[model samples]
Target: MAQAARLDIMSIAALVAFALTLGARTTFCEGISCGPGWEAFSSSCYKKMVDPNGWLGARFHCVLEGGDLVSFNSSAEEDFVKGKMGARSFWIGLSNLECNHKLCPQVSGKELKWSDNTLLNHSNWATVKVASTNLESCAYVLPNAHKDYHPGKWRKVSCESSLAYMCKRSPDGCQEGQPCNKTAGLALTPVQTSACDPGDFLRGHFCYRFENTKKTWQGAEDDCVLWGGHLASVHSREDGDWLIAHMEDNFHVGLKKNIKMFEWRDKTAMDPALWYPGYPSSDDCGRVSRTGQVYNHQCNSLIVFTCQKGVDVTHRHHQAHLVCAHLRSFSHPCSPAHSTSAAPRLE
Candidate 1:
């Protein structure tokens, strides 16, 4: 009778433990749930920025909000975006300028790819023929006849043009103790100020380091890549000013001039404003002037160059967590049950 009573107590204890565990899990899920303004779909959350801006501006805006421009991985994703899009067009995170042949002017090749480097298996390009040119290389959504309500279709547009943009993020971004940005609809780790790794200087979420050790234009690019980054690409005047103010000497930027043409290492057009007056039309590499203006220098000229490493490592890590969580939620691995002997052997 005492043994049976003890057994009953153990069972009750087990039930209580299970209840506590289930409640804890439920609380955790609620804690990490997407906050206001962000629409939840699957394991991810998304938000659309209403203000129109240039492609780079839109991209930067999304980054500041702790996400990137939206990129669809499947038809369901595309459909979700369409539903959010309504009748208005917006920018999606799709472009080839970063990996296109325009970067290597000397190398003969024709390749257009996405900025995120997603493998190409699906696309919803517009049927209408739009002239393909370097000027309008960035991708955007256009109207299509697939469905009257879902008018979003894909096409290239000039990156300089202003347009509304969308962002996609995952809920796993909410690290422990981090408060959610309910207004932006992101449950993300607090956006920290740019911090550089040892031997690098923080510059607006990018870590920059000037290597006085001279190398050719291509050699500099290779070195930067080996160091896990690329040659610096100056975007805003503020960026250029910062580089000029911080550098003791003129340094090569990612820009390379071959023949009479100039392009960034990523094959994107270097903003003409970055060039010093009467610059270019020369066969050489690009260098930052003391005044922050850009000028062409001989490609073989051994000169100091700056490298820029991104501070988005956390974003990538959180994305990996989201992928893992999705897989685990949907998959059930086989669990071997413990075998019971027909009867305990008399010992």
Candidate 2:
């Protein structure tokens, strides 16, 4: 409550106008309340990001805000989205794509699921099947831009296509008549992660920890997320070498082999020479041996693993006034800026 009650001293009117056009005027809309920059419906919070970016970039933006690209569980959610989202094509979380060698290629049998890995139970496909290629495997919601185009329906397209997007998350705990700590620009009340948790080693922009307990690839990844990190990703040989030297045992990594190539779990560029020769021929998951050699393995196999998260994300604050239409710089682990490896010192 102490953190949520902190008021950063912005004019109430200004805060409302800047963040998604919601102010005190709409706080009680539909008998629900959300943070200053979000709208509430059903049991979740929604924000429409008008700035156009690629699907990956847009998802990262939502991640920085502690959410993910919007996922619809039912038609009611879909209809709710249709009413709030503007009449412009926007990226939703549904995709049958995976990052492979810097390209978003279609997986042979992957279904269009939400980014959080939820199976699609309901859909509003544009009533046509668009053949997916190496580049056209992502789905986007179409707006009423054309009389012939069906608004609120979805279509498959290239992940690289720049489009606006929507983000969804549980609402910040603020009821009507409560003081919302959020500010305009959806700063979302930046929280301080000044240091990694105890026993985690701070290195460069991330903290790394080797887990001794064996767990399946998906299990390891989920544990990392629960610990505020992910299975460690290697973007350079130096980082790979560090992992080889410091990590204690074989483990599942964030990289996964798909379509004959390996892609980093965070979707950063992968080092081409990190794999052991004759390895990674046709496995679904990735593991790094003690020698730093990358290998592909069955995703359901159990193994120890490593986790990594940004070292520190400085708290950000902006006041006075901010224009509502554009996105600010990303200052967290989800951004590519935090992906590089720096000199490591275990604490």
Candidate 3:
């Protein structure tokens, strides 16, 4: 019997030692804290900002800081943020631009995509609706015990509404152009445009040149493709106006038919077909000419053409310029134009 008790005591001692080792490796402290502008989130930290600016302006601010607006990824994340925010209202990075500004319930199944084309595939939303003004086409979250709506509820409001907000950064790596400055308190600086010259016919998200160089529809398409872009397809009247503003002469876009009279080359047909009123007639297949303030064109006739591709600043300076011109110009600064303190923010 004495031997049995001794064996049991030995087993208890081994268990105690194992637990102590584990506790050392995974220590949890009560009331742990992070630096200013940062709130504790599980094992990481987040920054919350309250911008009184409208939705568009708020979005600009977040991008200026090299981050998209807030997109919650989980219920626990939302609840944790709410607890940190206390009773204040804050903006989240979501909008119903595609849905005509209506409030959407907690998005399920496929994740939502932001206007800049970023995916909000993670969790970070409430299941209830909060008070919002009709002018409020944007959404925000409130943190409090008021579970008046279920947890993770989102309130749609006007973009013009002023509210507090939260910002998140991956504790693992800082975004490019944003440095972790211990002295500056984690605030992001604006990204700088490089000194490289703009490529062949591209400037600021629009592709163009000052002189009209003659080429066939096929030739123009080939030139654009050589530059790693295809012929342009104007999406809106605004696009037409933009093209007109830069051109010293008329140009052609892809929209031609083969000798067989079948429509080819104009790749934009794959997208929702958009044309000026009374456009795309049998005779107008490849025609584009500028008349005073308007543009007219035929697909088969040769005129200078514009092509476009997306831009990435991280690319080599020359390559970036070539790519930007081939795709489209980076016309808008990464930051919006209205704020002097704000810098350009790209996706």
Candidate 4:
């Protein structure tokens, strides 16, 4: 999420390449503090992003900043966010994109989820009752001060609507009992100040690092494995767009033609329909271009690649809650599975 702090990102399609160099920055930290422009509120730090973007794109920017789209877990939190928003509607981390009425609990018949993958325990919706359908939808908060809109109320909209967004992160900076120097202002990391590694970008609870160092597909995957992660895996259009936004040229991604289908090393299920145009399905490796197109590639070809790592317990627990909640909807008594099997690391 390093890129989010520096750019307004009103339109990622207009992004320009910029130079960024980092020294030896590693993952794992000890403490944190709210940086400039971030307000300390309750248990987290809040930052209002002044940019227009679709819900997914907005959330992507927040993840770049080492956070996710803001989640108002209570009425007070909702009011706090309303007070922070100026006149613009801001995208929140709430959605019902995966809601299947039969498999999940319904809020107005729509199951909402936060970007952090948590279920909605509280709501601040207006008259807009999102229609239950298979189509994706998101929620955004309207400023009450505006006479034309409902005050402190969330409105359902297509996830494609561009709007300003809010971000929240756990404060991290020099602190007592940690190997840190209070004198060193801002954040003490190898790269920038974020929840993930200083340099890695956070997306959907996963941390990704883009490496420009060209290496063969296998060599790239090996290096990522050496670093305790795996090659990057693209999950959706947003993921593909995110890669295009940060990268300037063609790069290798973590997928290979295994028999008749492409497989993600991390075990993420592939959506066959997501592959566009066509990937002759012949080459052994996968490559992505700045335009978000995938191609069949020779495994030994040298190219830059990305690496990905797992998230913390909070994120994992959120996933478990989602699955458990679904199972419970079927009347099956079950407990939340707090952990998951380790899969191949992805960049």
Which candidate wins on TM-score?
A: 4
State the RMSD for candidate 2. 19.0
- In Å, residue 196's CA in model 4 sits off its true spot by 31
lDDT for each of the candidates? 0.53, 0.56, 0.42, 0.56
Candidate 3, run of 10 with poorest lDDT: 338-347
Which lDDT tens digits does candidate 1 get at residues 150-235? 24667554343345678766676532322223333332221111123333443434566667788888888888999888999877
Question: What shift in Å separates residue 262 of candidate 4 from its native position after superposition?
Answer: 56
Model 3: lDDT equals 0.42
Better of 1 and 3 by TM-score: 1
Per-residue lDDT tens digits for candidate 3, residues 1-347, read 11211221222222222222333343223232454566556655677664344344344344433344556666677777777666665667776533211112222223234433335655444443323222214566643212333333564433333466665554443333332333323222222122112322223333332225778766777777776666666654445544443443466665554543434354433122344446545554443334212233554565555665433322323322332232223231121112112112110
Whole-model lDDT, model 1? 0.53
Q: Lowest summed-lDDT stretch of 10 residues in model 1?
A: 100-109
Please, what is the TM-score per model? 0.36, 0.38, 0.33, 0.39
Candidate 1 Cα errors over 4 Å, as ranges:
1-32, 99-111, 128-136, 144-151, 174-347
| Residue pairs whose backbone atoms clash in candidate 1 | 103-267
Model 2 lDDT, residue 342, Cα: 28
Model 4, stretches more than 4 Å misplaced?
Answer: 1-30, 98-110, 144-149, 172-347
